[model samples]
Target: MTYCVGMVLEKGLVLMSDTRTNSGVDNISVFRKMFTWQVPGERIITLMTAGNLATTQAVISQLEERTKEPDERDNILLKSPTMFQVATEIGRLMRGIISERQDANGVKGRGRFTASIIVAGQIKGMEPRLFMVYPEGNFIEASLDTPFFQIGETKYGRPIILRGYDRQMSLEDAAKLLMVSFDSTLKANLSVGLPLDLQVIERDTYEAGHQHRIGHDDSYFAAISDGWGDALKNAFHSLPDYSFYRPDD
Candidate 1:
């Protein structure tokens, strides 16, 4: 399992995904779950995936292969005229791969090889958009009512985002909020570990804005992790004391 989030802010978009996958206690390992495709000044796309490792990897590989051999087939990521079309194309590809493999592997493998992905990016002249593609190939776009999407090991980190998210906040604040969500997840779950991969894309700029990997020794992440814990403890202590007995007693 893993934890990944893609948030759409008024200023831009922020995406983060941890790099861990586990089969069992002794078989735990790390694998990057974020992938990006960009065309410098024309377009920028980020895809974060979670679920069966093999299926996700296969979809990513096929997408990458499209970029390299554009003449042979429709390089939808490069040629899609709108962000919606891009999401549609990605959804189609995801479904195709999942279904194809399921047929070959048989009915018993139905849910075993399933995968889901979060697609975030913008085409030139388009607003930055975010979508969460389901394992079945259908998807839903992010909106003001729900401006972010998370997949895999989500319960631990979701509450933080719900209480803190603001569509008007700057990209920096959005990233910081996600870091806290990630820290909360890391503390509670072993299936999701880091170094985490993060990327930001500013509105109207058809280029990758900021990118980084947060490893164990990353100082800023270390501070965020420690600071959050201290803050929580202080908040708990600051709460008014409650008593079961009457104050006079």
Candidate 2:
């Protein structure tokens, strides 16, 4: 399992993903879950993937290869005139790949090749956008009502985002919020171990403002984790005590 989030804000986009893959408790490894392509000042796209490692890697590889081959049909980087179209293309690719794998394996029920992705970026003349692509090649864009999307082992971290997210918050605050969410997930689930990848894209810049890999020993993340735990505990204690002593009966 993995955890990945893509958030759309008034400022731009913030994306994060963990890099752990495991077949069993005894077998574990780290593989990058974040991928990016940029055309200098023209456009920048970032993708974070979750679910079956083979399926996700295959999709990313095909997209990368298409970018390199000028004659390839409607590759992710070339054919999409808008961020929406880019997401559509990726969804189509993911569905096609999973279907082919399922057919080859003669599998029934949900196929083992299921996966999802978060696609976030901006084009030269368009507003920044973020999307969550499902296994069936369908997707939903982030809107004012819902300014963020998360994929993969998400439940453990969602509450933090729900309580803390602010569309107008500065990128620095957004990053800190994500760190708290990720720290909570890491503490609760062994499958979501770290060496996280994060990207911040400022609106209209068509370039990534910050891209970083946070390892287990990153001091800032450590501080955020420790501080968030203390803060939450303190808040819990400060809440007004329940009126259980009121003897109405």
**TM-score for each predicted model, relative to the true structure:** 0.92, 0.94
Residue range 1-249, candidate 2, lDDT tens digits: 899988988889999999999999889999999988888688999999999888888898777665466665445665579988888888988998999999899976576889999999999999998889999999998899899998888899999899999999999889888999999999999999889999999998888789899998899998988898889999999998778677674
- Largest TM-score belongs to which candidate? 2
lDDT of each: 0.89, 0.89
Q: Which whole-number lDDT from 0 to 100 does residue 84 have in model 2?
A: 86
Instruction: State candidate 2's TM-score.
Output: 0.94
Q: What is the lDDT of residue 61 in candidate 1?
A: 72
Residue 66 CA error for candidate 2 (Å)? 5.9
Cα RMSD for predicted model 2: 2.0
**Which window of ten consecutive residues has the lowest lDDT sum in model 2?**
66-75
Tens digit per residue, CA lDDT, model 1, 1-249: 899999999999999999999998779888989888789888998889999898898888776564466667655577778878877877788888888888887844447788999999988877899999887878999998999999999999999899999999999999999999999999999889999999999998989999999999999999999999899999888998888897698
